[model samples]
Target: MIGSLDIAIICIYLLAVLAFGWMFYRKQTDASSFTRGNGRLPVWALSLSVFATFVSSISFLALPGNAFAKDWSSFVFSLSIPITAFLAVRFFVPLYRKINSDSAYAFLEERFGRWARIYASVCYLLTQLARMGAILYLLALPVNSLTGLGLEQIIVITGLLVLLYSTLGGIEAVVYTDAIQGILLISGAFLCLYFILSKIDGGFGGMWQEALQNHKLSLGSFAFDWKSSSFWLILFYGFFINLQNFGADQSYIQRYMSAKSVKDAQKTVWLGGLLYVPVSLLFFLIGTALWVYYFQNPLPEAIPADQVFPHFISTELPVGIKGLLIAAILSAGMSTLSTSVNSSATVLLTDIFKIETANSLRFLRTASAIMAACSIVAALLFLGVDSALDVWWALASIFSGGILGLFLLGLLVKKSAAKLAVSIGLVFVLWTSLSQMFPESPWAFTLHPNFVIIIGTTLIFAVGWLLRKKD
Candidate 1:
């Protein structure tokens, strides 16, 4: 195991994050400050924050493993990012800003009523917990193997440290920490790419041939699933997941809200989307390189492919480079956690507490504290999940069906069909998801995950529109 240096670097990274949280704590005693940094942040700052919120540990570690095991077919999904950003910026961001609301779900209450608002808020809260928990669990895998810490202790300690600063400092703290984490993550990814290629003997072409010989370098990763992870199938599947972020997730929304204006929010999101393609490809490339590395030089024993990146980092890299890799892991874990903890509190206060409508600093503080506690508990429970990516997809898929309905209905549907549209839309998503979940699924529907959000959302809106017109 790569011992003390890795532990030292990670501990330093946490302290830096803590210092940032404290620096931003300019007495965030009210709801607005806690949720959104008083809406004074620059567009660039919020954009970077959005980027940080997404560059998660799962992406840091798992994306490469996935691509290595599979192929560039993952890029098919990566393409959905720019399109999703366009939807978020041009449509959803403006809609929420026009409502001038802190919580994205508040748009539900404005268009629908209190029940709808509560429903969306509750869903966002539950989903954020799931995401945060998955973040820690993924982090635990890397930290435990490298540092000899037990998974349970690592989970608790990681959860507590994140909850402490996030609860104390609020959105400003979250954004700053995320901004730093994002930069570190992006740089670290490319650095890892550079090092992996350097060691591969032949630069790019040589590595390519090695992967090709071993059935690793195929670009047609979708260019179809054998039941799971097919090439062309991933294209549509990736789009559905991206749409949920561009359309629904509160963490995504809250980052947009932090922007100086709607235009800034829109521009930032699209830019981030454009940025994702190249950055994401690096993950796949690293995966392929590792595959070649193993093919050319076999791992010591039955090392998990998921540990492929770590195996390279621990064994091949010099000591100082190993420290930097540990820091990259911090970049993955803390950035996402900071953004999530802030977003969760935003949902709790803005949507759940309805605090903006009232004046209660004490109430806001109390709510912040309660939200932090909930986040810790949520992370603990999330540690129990067996698979990170499946849970991540399921979460985004479920919430998206309804949120897509709300956004579409809000913008296009007339008053007569509004309530029915929402009702039918909810049922459509539920039924599709339920059918997809059953063991003996009928192939007649071809219940591929690619269509989960796309088909589920479209049918709900399109069918509801037809029925409403007839009525």
Candidate 2:
């Protein structure tokens, strides 16, 4: 169990986050500021916010778990970010900026129709809800195990705290807090690495030799198999998913539109993309070190990879440091959760309802609270999930399919027929639903989760183009 000092440290960190969020309360005068910020946040801060949002509690928990259980094949997903960011800055940023709307789905309405806008927005909302739930579950699982708190209790406490601040302060709070949390997340990972190395015999050299001998340093499989996690398959998946993240995801687009200018937004995207690679590598290294540490000093029995890091925290680290690390995990979860609540609310108000009332802020706050509640429910639903990373990727791939497909059809296919676009989108929706529901079915079993987005998006573009030509 964690000591009182550790609990106190965590409480203090939570309070500090609440206080930081409250600082922005006065600035949120309207829906625009509430959802998109003051439009003068520094490019660097926005960049850090982007990094934090992208990394989230999923990365905090899952990356280390991944390294401990598997290899660095997943690192390819992070590697593709820079490539996508470059394409986004060069092409997508200008287009989104030119449209100049708070909702990223606004362009869909103009390009396709109201149905397209609604379709894409609904997909995004579902995706965010699933993501929020998975993130909350991942965060609460370890904390609950470590502290002997009920999972539901942990979910409510953390969910409500994030809800309170996000409802009170809005997007400004989300971004600013994210910037602080981003640094803390990286620092915490670095501290873990340092501690692990200190305990290893002969330091870095010994650790490296151990890792090499055990083949823990393997990058991934290079075979072209679609039924398994091969390098090319992951790379292709990463390329498409990263494109969806930069080009279509609302959390990122909100930051892009919140910047002072298009150029500033573009800079923020590139800078955040560059920063992610090293930070991710650090987390993977920590996992590798954990593998070596345990090899030298084996546990009584094996624990789940996802539980290993938190188990180590509760048993190994001294009090204050353990608290700090716990706080870092909470910071990661809050940064992502708060952003989701605010952005989900933004989408609800702007795209779905089109509310323009005098009490817009009240409506927005209400929406934020409701979204937070829904995310908590979703998180609870995922309590039985085995692998946080796999479940998250599956949910992400399933939800992202229609929206990414629609976006590509709108952006690249000129003179698209509305019926054809809708048809293509429906095909993707049906494909994703069936694939997710019957993963063991022969047709679906061969289509890895990693390739879902790529295949769905490509199918939409290809079919939509052919239909457009016929039209």
Model 2 global lDDT (CA atoms, 0 to 1): 0.85
Question: What would the per-residue lDDT of candidate 1 be over residues 173-227, giving only the tens digit for each residue?
Answer: 8877777777888888888888888878787888888777777655555424534
lDDT of 1: 0.71
- Return the TM-score for each candidate structure: 0.89, 0.96
Lowest lDDT 10-residue stretch of candidate 2: 462-471
Positional deviation of residue 114's Cα in model 2 after best superposition, in angstroms: 0.3
Q: Which ranges in model 1 have alpha carbons more than 4 Å from their true place?
A: 3-5, 213-228, 356-387, 399-401, 416-438, 441-446, 469-471
Residue-level error in angstroms, candidate 1, position 135? 1.4
Q: Write candidate 2's Cα lDDT for 1-471 as tens digits.
A: 888998899989999999988898898889889988867778988999988987887888888889888878888888888889999999889998888888899998988889888887888899899999989988996698669999899998999999999998998899989999999988888887898899889788998898888888787899898678888877888888888888998888889889999999999999987898888888888888888888889989978888788878878888788888888998889899998999889899889999876777889999999999999999999887778888888777777755777787787776677556556656765665687688887766346776677777777777777766432
Q: Name the best candidate (by lDDT).
A: 2
What does candidate 2 score on TM? 0.96
